[model samples]
Target: MLKFEKVSLTFKTEGREQHVLKDLSYTFETGRITAITGVSGIGKTTILNLAAGLLETSEGSVINTFAKTAYVFQEPRLLPWKTALENVTCVCGDEKKAKFYLDILLPEGSDKYPDELSGGMQQRVSIARAMAYDAELVLLDEALKGLDMQTKDAVVKTLREHLKGRTAIMITHDKSELEFCDTVLEISDAPISELKHVNR
Candidate 1:
């Protein structure tokens, strides 16, 4: 389980203090998929970073109990020198498990390097790497942004299967993605003050 107790995050930019989160309190239950949707630059990704312990809160506290967490960023963030299969295997050190996810996400490009694959294909490889890791919590930041509709549907289905019985949070601009999640959090305002649960 992950809990944010009046968490606040502030960044210093060019001698100005920018507050991203302000006295925000929320709980992400265990073994559930939560989808976060909001306008651009509203600090949705910052929440994920805080959950993953990649960023520290300026005030308050973040309580995360999950032993392992995997994050798929907006970019593929793959190694240019490693093949798709290698990238996936690098996390879990299991080629068989890596191949299994790659076969589902990037079947044809498993042997290809990051530079050789298209943007969508590279993103798929990145997703496969996270899936292969089998972490207790998964964080996705616009993970399906560039895929075609058909491909996006297929990848979402695959993710749904892999994410079962795990805690997952994703930030997406697409409304259709909300239907697959157990909970949808809609955030607004420049400095996010609250997270509202959107009724499905």
Candidate 2:
């Protein structure tokens, strides 16, 4: 389970304070997939960072009980020198299991380096790495931004199957991506005072 209690995050830029989240409170229930949607630069990714403990809040607290967590950033962030298979295997250290996910997400270019693959393919490889880790909680930031329709369909299906009974939080700009989530939270307003639940 993940809980945010009156969480607030502020950053100082050019000697000026910028508030991203102000007195925001929300709970991301476990064993569910939650999708967060909002305009760019509205601090959607910041929320994911806070959940992953990658950033500290200026006030309040974030409690995450899950033992293992995996994060797939907007960028593939794969090792440029490593092949697709190696990037996934490096995290879980299980070639067989890594290949399992690679086959589903990157059937064609598992042996290709990051430079050798296209942007969409590289993003798929990142997703495969996270899935291969078998994490209890997964945080995805625009994980499907650049995929073609067919590839997106395949990857979405794979994610739905693999994320069963696990906690997942995804940030996406595309509304079509919300189909795989159980709950959709839309963040608006400067400083992010609250999240409005969008029924689907």
Candidate 3:
């Protein structure tokens, strides 16, 4: 039951304003994945940020029922100073579950610093971190950008296994990613003309 009601967002820097998202409204069913696909620089990440409440909307509401959320950004935002285990342990999300998924996503010898692991391993650590957070909503913004096909498939499979029956919103240009989701939403400059009517 997540929703956006006439939401619009803008950013101002040095007296210059950038319109990131135009007025838009939509809803997502609970316990399902919703994929948002569009060209680059078209407010895709912004939508995920709004849902996670990382940014304030300039107009209208970004409605979410959950107070806790998990965010897996484009880059693996692992803390440089923390070890792989410590990074996931930071959230205190079911110590056993954390270790379990961490073992599933990351392979042997990955229990090292971000600098010590490969790019794909670091992303797996980030995914493990997100899963450890135990949030109701997981917002992923191209979190699998640089991984090779095999690694990406493995990581995606791991995530899906853990995200079963949870709500997830992902932004990806790859049509293949749509297979992981229940609904495919295409956002663009074109307007949604039809308005559905519901009775009280």
Residue 48 in candidate 1 has what lDDT? 94
TM-score of 3: 0.89
Q: lDDT by residue for model 1 over 76-157, one digit each (tens)?
A: 9998999999999999899999999999988797999999999999999999999999999999999999998988889999
- Model 1 ranges with Cα > 4 A deviation: none
Per-residue lDDT over 77-128 for candidate 3, one digit per residue giving the tens place of the 0 to 100 score: 8888988887888775466766876888886744698999888888888888
For model 2 the local lDDT of residue 104 reads 90
Clashing pairs in 1: none
Cα misplacement distance, residue 30 of candidate 2 (Å): 0.9
Model 2 weakest 10-residue run by lDDT: 172-181
Better of 1 and 3 by TM-score: 1
How many residue pairs of model 1 clash at the backbone?
0
RMSD of 3: 4.2
TM-score of each: 0.97, 0.97, 0.89
